[model samples]
Target chain A: MSVVDLSKQVALGIDIGGTNTKFGLVNHRGQILAKGSIPTDQYNTPEEFIDALYKEIQPLIDEHGVEKMIEGIGVGAPNANYYRGTIEQAPNLPWKGVIQFADLMTEKFGQPCKMTNDANAAALGEMMYGAARGMKDFIMITLGTGVGSGIVSGGNLIYGHDGFAGELGHTIVKPGGRKHWSTGSEGSLEAYASATGIAITAKKMRAEFPDSMLNQFPEEAINSKTVHECALKEDPVAIEVFRYTGQKLGEALANFVMFSSPEAILLFGGVIKAGDFILKPAKLHMERNLLPIFRNKVRLVFSELDEADAAILGASALVWEK
Target chain B: MSVVDLSKQVALGIDIGGTNTKFGLVNHRGQILAKGSIPTDQYNTPEEFIDALYKEIQPLIDEHGVEKMIEGIGVGAPNANYYRGTIEQAPNLPWKGVIQFADLMTEKFGQPCKMTNDANAAALGEMMYGAARGMKDFIMITLGTGVGSGIVSGGNLIYGHDGFAGELGHTIVKPGGRKHWSTGSEGSLEAYASATGIAITAKKMRAEFPDSMLNQFPEEAINSKTVHECALKEDPVAIEVFRYTGQKLGEALANFVMFSSPEAILLFGGVIKAGDFILKPAKLHMERNLLPIFRNKVRLVFSELDEADAAILGASALVWEK
Candidate 1:
C-alpha cells in the first residue's frame, strides 16, 4: 500500500433524524465500510441515546479493523450548531435542552468529533461527494417535514455574522394566508410545501371533495409518494395538490433566487420523490416569476446523491471539510 | 488648508432615479462640497441624457472650484453594471440597449470613473456614510417605482458569481397569483408593494369602491404619499393598502434574512418616506415570518444616510476602497 493511502484515517459519521439514528464508518475517499441505523426512541435521554448508538457501532468498528485508524466522529442533527457543537432544543427531538452530542460521541470512542446542523451537513456532503463536488457556489434544499436549506457560496458554507443564516424554508411565499398549523397566520410556504404540510393540504382538499378519489386513503396514510402515484394515475385531486404545492415552492424559490442567485438548488427528501409532479409546476411558476436576467438561468434539480447513504456521507464529509 | 487636505482629490457622485438624478462632490474625507439635482427626462436617449446632466452639473462643479480637486466620477443608474461599466436595457430607463455610460463620462471628463446599479451604490453609500457606517453586513432596500436592493456581507458587497446576487425586489411573496410587471408573474412582492404596484392595487380597489375618498385624486396622482395621507385618516382602503404592502415587504425580507442574516435591513426612497406608515406594519409581519432562531434578533431600520449626499459619498468611497 502507498504511504498516502495509509495516512488517511476513517471517520465515524452519524445522522440523528427524528425517526432514526443512522451511522457509518467512512474514509476520505467517500467509501463506506459499514453502515446501519437504529430506531430513535423519543423518550430516551441524550445519554441513553448515545449509549444505544455506541452499542450498535462498537461491533462495526471491530469488524472493520478501524479502531486505531479512526480519526474522529462527525454528526448531523436537527437544530445542531457547527460553531457551538451542540443541538439546541430541536422541535422534532423529545430532548428538552441543548446536548453536546459530539462530545458524548468523543467520550465513548476516545476520538475527536465535530457536528453541524443536518441541512449544513448535507451541503458539505454535496461539496465532498455529490452533484456539487467540483462546484463552489450552490444551494441545497431538503423538503422533508419542514423545508431546510443550506447555501454554499464562493466554496465556503455561509454561516453569516451570527452563524444563523440559511433559513430558506421560512422565507414567505404567501404574504397573507392560512397554514393549517399552530403557528397561526398564513403566508409561509413551509405551511403547505413540506412533506407533512403537503399531506395536510391533500387531506383538507379531500374533505372539501368528500367523494373525490383522494378520500380512498385515510389522512394518516397520505404521503408525497402516494400523492405522486395517484397523480400519475390522472387523479385530479392529487394533481391539484402537487400543482398547488409546486406553485408555493416556486414562489418561495423565486425569493431565494433573488437573494443568492445560486447556480442551482438541489432538492431532496420525501416531497421531491414525486419528482416532476412537483418540479414541472415549480419550474413553470418560478420561470414566470423570475426576473428576465434570471430566466432559465437558475436550475431546480433533484439530488443525485443517494438518500439512504446521504446522511452518513454528509456527516462524514463534515470532518473532511474541517 | 493643511497640506493633507489640499492634496486630497474629490469625486463627483451621481445617483439617477426614474424621477431625479441627485449629485454630490465628495472629498476623501467623506465631506460633500455641493449637492443638487435635475429632473430625468424619460424621452431622452442615453447620449442626450448625458448632455442634459452635464449642462445641469457643469455650473455646480465650477461654483465649488471642484474642477481641479476632482479626481474621478462615480455614477449610480438603474441597471448599471460595475463589471461591464454599462447600463443594459434598464426597466425604468427609456434606453433600449447597452450604453457605455462610464465611458461616456470618462470621455467627457478625461478622468477614471466607476459605476454600479443604483441600489448597489446606495448600499455602498449606507456602508460609507449612513446607519451601516463601519458595519460590513446589511441590506439596503430602495422602495420606489420598483423595489431594488443592495447587499453587503462580510465587509464586501455580495455581487454573486455574476454581478447580480442582490436583486431582493424580485423575490416572490405570493405563489402563482399576481403578475409583476418586471417579471411578468404572480408572486413577486414588487407586484403588490412597490410604489407603482401599490398605486395599481389602489386603482383596482378604487374601481371596487367608486365613492371612496381615494377617487377624489386624478389617477396619475395616486402615490404612496397619498396612500399615507388617507391611511393616517383611517381610510379603510388606504389602511388595507399599507397593511397589504407592509405584509409583503416583511415577508420578502424574511427570505433575505434567511440568506444574509445581516445586522439590519436599511429602507430608503419614496415609499419609505411614509416612515411609520410603511415601517410599523412591515416590522410586525417580518417578525411573524422570521425563523425562531432569527426572531427579534435582526432589525428593520430606515437609512440614516442623507439621500443626496449618500450617493456621492458612496461613489467617492468606491475609489477609496479600491
Candidate 2:
C-alpha cells in the first residue's frame, strides 16, 4: 500500500481576462505554490490560446505532478457556463463563439476540469476562504471595469436553468438613465456602480464644478483611484461621484436582498477600495430603500481576498467547491 | 404488521387570511376531502383564534380519526415562519408581536405542525401540484390586493435568514414615482402593479380622458375588474391603465430575471385575470428591458392552480413537502 502526501495535492487555477490571463497552482488552504501570467489577447483562435496555455502550464504540472492534483483544474472566464463547461461568445475574449474550454483542458492535461463565470468563482472563493466564511447565503458584487454579481441561496450558488444566472450588473437600476458604453443598455447597475462608471461620474460631475479638484487632472486621468485620492482631500465633486455610485449600488442591492434575502453583501474589485467613502452612502441608501423587515438585517462589507490574487484563488476554489 | 390504509392518509391544511381563515382535509393526491371557513378578524387574541380553530376542526378530526392523518397539520398565514413555527408581526393579522402558532397547533391537535407565509405556501402548492410541477426553478408572483412573490430556486422555496425572503412587491421599480397606500414607501412594485394600484391608475388616468368609459363609473367602482371590463369594450383610458401597470411589472420582472434566472415566473391573483391586456404589455416590456442572454428565455405564465383553492392546497403541501 502507498501512503498519500496530503500536503502536496494541488489544483491549477486559471483566470482568463481580456488583457492578461493568470494561472496558479494552489493548495486546499488557498496558498499559491506557483503562478504565471500570459497575455490573453495575443491568441486569435481558441486553438491557439489552448496551445499557448498548455506550453506555459506544462512545467508547473510536471513539478506539481498529476498524481498530486486530486482536485484537478478549475477555470474562470467571461461568459463561462459551469454546467456546460464552455465559454459562449465572451465579449472580451478573442474567441468569437462557443469554446469547449473545460473539454480542451481535460483533453490536453488528462485531468478533470470545471469552469464557471468569474463572478460565480469569486463567490465560491469568498464562501470557502474569505469574508463569507460561515454564511450560507450572501451576494458577491465585483465592481471592476464592469459590475458583476454572484448570488448564493440556501448555501448554493444560483446557476439558474441555463447556468447563466446572477447577472445583476445588467439589471437596470435607472430606467432611461445612463447608457452603457459596450452593451448600450440604459441604466444598468454596471453603468453607474463600476470603476468605469465612477470615471464617467467624475468627468460629468467635474464639468459642472469647473474649479473642482478633479478638473486639475487630465480627462483621461480621472478614474476611480484619482477620484478616491481627491475625496481623501475633501474634494466636493469627487465626494459626489462616490455618493452617486453608492446610491445606485445600494438601491440595486436592496432589490437583490428582497429577492434572495442574503445575510450579507460582499463588495470586491477596485471601486470598493474607496472604502467608507462609497460604503457609507451605499449602506444608508440600502437601509432607506429596504422594507422594515429587511432593514438593519443585511450586512454590507468589502471582500477580504487580495485583489491581485483573487482571480486565480477564486478559480481554484471551483475545483474544491464542486 | 397491519396494512396501512393509503387512501385514508391525509393532511390538514389551514390558510389564514386577514378577513377569513380557510382550511381543508386533503389526501396525498391533492384531493380535498372536506373544507370549511371561519371569520378571522373577530378573535381578539391568538389564543382565542387557536381555540376557535380547535373547536371547528374537532368534528372533522373525530370523523377522519387520528390514524388517517399521517401528514399532520400545516398552516399558512401573513407572516408565518417555518423554522421557528411562529407568526411574527403580521401587519394584516389581529396578532401583534410574535405568536407561537405552530406550537399551539401541535399542542391542540396532538400532531406535528409546520408553518410558512402564504406566498411561500402558494409556491409550494404550485411546485407540488400546479404550474411549476416537474420544474426545479421558478418564481411565483401573486398580483391581487398586493403583489406578493415566492421564489423557488433549485426546487426549494427561499425562506431567507429571518424566514422572510422573496418580497418582490416591495422592490422599487420607479424611484420617487408613486407612494404605496399601506407601506408608505414610494415607488414600490405593489404601488404600481397591484389591483389597488390599477384602480388608483384608472382614477388618475380617467381624469385626462373624461370621454373615456372609465369616467362613467364612480370612483369607488374603478378597480381592476371594472377596468378589464372597460378594456374589453375598447376603452382607451382603461387600456392605458393596464399598459402602465404591465410596464412597471415587466421592468421589475427583468430585474428579477437577471437576479435568479428562474425557468418561469408564474402570475396569480385577480389582477392576472385581465389576460392579454396585461400579459402582452408585460411580455413586451420585460423583453425590452432584459439583456440579450436573458431575452425571450423565461416563461411568464398564469398559475394552473385555482385561486380559491391555491392557499389551502399550498398550506396542505407543506405537510407533504416537509
Q: For residues B48-81, could you state the per-residue lDDT of candidate 2 as single tens digits? A: 9989988888887787675444578889998888
Mark the 10 consecutive residues where model 1 chain A has the least summed lDDT.
Answer: A178-187
Query: Residue B104 in model 2: shift from native, Å?
Result: 0.9
Once all C-alphas are superposed, what RMSD does model 2 give against the true structure?
A: 1.5
Q: lDDT for each of the candidates? A: 0.80, 0.90
Residue-level error in angstroms, candidate 2, position A90: 0.9
Chain B TM-scores per candidate, in order, are 0.88, 0.97
Local accuracy of candidate 1 as per-residue lDDT tens digits, A1-322: 6464643478899998888989999888788889999887654788888888888899999988768888788898888877678888788887868888778778877888888788888988888988887876688889988888888876777776676678777666665675637456466667878987888889888788776678888767887877887898888898999999998788677767777677888888878888888899998877776778877888788887889988899999888774
Candidate 2 chain B, poorest ten consecutive residues by summed lDDT: B61-70
Fnat, model 1, is 0.70
DockQ of each: 0.51, 0.80
Q: How close is candidate 1 to the true structure, as a TM-score?
A: 0.85
Choose the strongest candidate by DockQ: 2
